[model samples]
Target: MPQMIFVNLPVTDLDRSTAFYEAVGATKNPRFSDDTASGMVITDAIHVMLLTHDKWRQFTDRQIPDAKISAQVMLCLSHDSRESVDQVVARAGTAGGRIDPNPVQDYGFMYGRSYADPDGHIWEVMWMDAAAAEAGPEAFAAEAAAT
Candidate 1:
């Protein structure tokens, strides 16, 4: 079996966070969900666990940073096409998330956009041409020099 990954995040409101992720195409997995936690399945390999602040504290004593004030980490996702990236951003906005503060980037070989969820967790989505990405540094350098 392949390795699976789960990103656990602390949320102020369990229901709200669950709803936001559901809007982004995640499905709730009841096997791992409860009153204080919800499992949002993004894909077969990737899942996100939304844990209430109270439940999160039981695991660690580290302070949970305020999502509105400071960024602890940024999550990134990949899409098959540029249009898919745009779609994700739009869905996020309609779900009460904020639009990407930065302009979309298109480098011919790669494209990307970023948006923040209602809880202020930034999510970046990108699409890359497999051929160009496989070309590695040379391709990036050429694109950079041309811009």
Candidate 2:
């Protein structure tokens, strides 16, 4: 079986968090979800587990980080196109998220932008073309000039 990554996040309100993820295009997996927690499917191998504060504590002895004021982890995902990255962030904002000051720009072959969810969880949306990335920033500029 292929290894998978499960990103566990502590949420003050499970319902609100579930709704936010749904709005951002993740589907809830009923088989692994319940009133206390929900598994949001980002991809076949990647998932975000949104657990209530109490439920989260049951999984660890340490205190949950105050995502609103602290940085525990920054979750990032890549898109197939630049417009898709913008769409995700835009949807997040419409769902009560806030956009970070930075904008997406061509950095060699990577283009991405960051945002904060309603609960202040940081998420970076990016679009990277492998061919463009392999060409490097200098090559990209030269190709653009030639075009």
Candidate 3:
């Protein structure tokens, strides 16, 4: 199976987008670097292609949705604990990212929070304790089970 996951997203400003992603802890891949785009490396398996408006338009004929008005995609990542989620949330805010007002919490099992990058792309940061999660969906099947 192919191990890499590629996500191409349109950005109004590549430099600003790059800075925002870097602030969120993603690195840049020089192999795909150029005046037109930047490869924001999310992980060894994941890469987000941050393309300029013109460069992005070349990929599709449909109009680009104003992400600020409506988000087309919600990027999600998993963490190990709630503290980890809060840490990244804080980092993102300091780096110019916007945190969602409310977060979902599955005490002792899972938790998730949302944020928007500088380019207005939505990202949901989540945490799930494997041992706790291994208990399966029934663990959070209902609020009664959560407690």
The number of the candidate with the highest lDDT is 1
lDDT of 1 by residue, 1-147 (tens): 999999989988889889999998999999999999999999999999999989999999999988777898988899999999999899988988888855778877889998877677888999998888999857787877998
Give the least accurate 10-residue stretch of model 2, judged by summed lDDT.
100-109
**What digit string (tens of lDDT, one per residue) describes model 2 on residues 1-147?**
899999999888888899999999999999999989999999999999999888998989897878778897888898998889889889988988888634656674678987887778999988887887787777887887898
- Candidate 3's displacement at residue 81, Å, is 2.0
Q: What is the lDDT of residue 100 in candidate 3?
A: 76
| Clash count per candidate | 0, 0, 0
Task: Report the CA-based lDDT of candidate 1 relative to the real structure.
Answer: 0.89
lDDT, residue 115, candidate 2: 81
Per-candidate TM-scores read: 0.91, 0.88, 0.88
Candidate 2: segments with Cα more than 4 A from true spot: 101-105, 141-147
Query: In candidate 1, which residue pairs clash?
Result: none
TM-score: which candidate is best? 1
Error at 64, model 3, angstroms:
0.5
Score residue 105 of candidate 2 by CA lDDT. 63
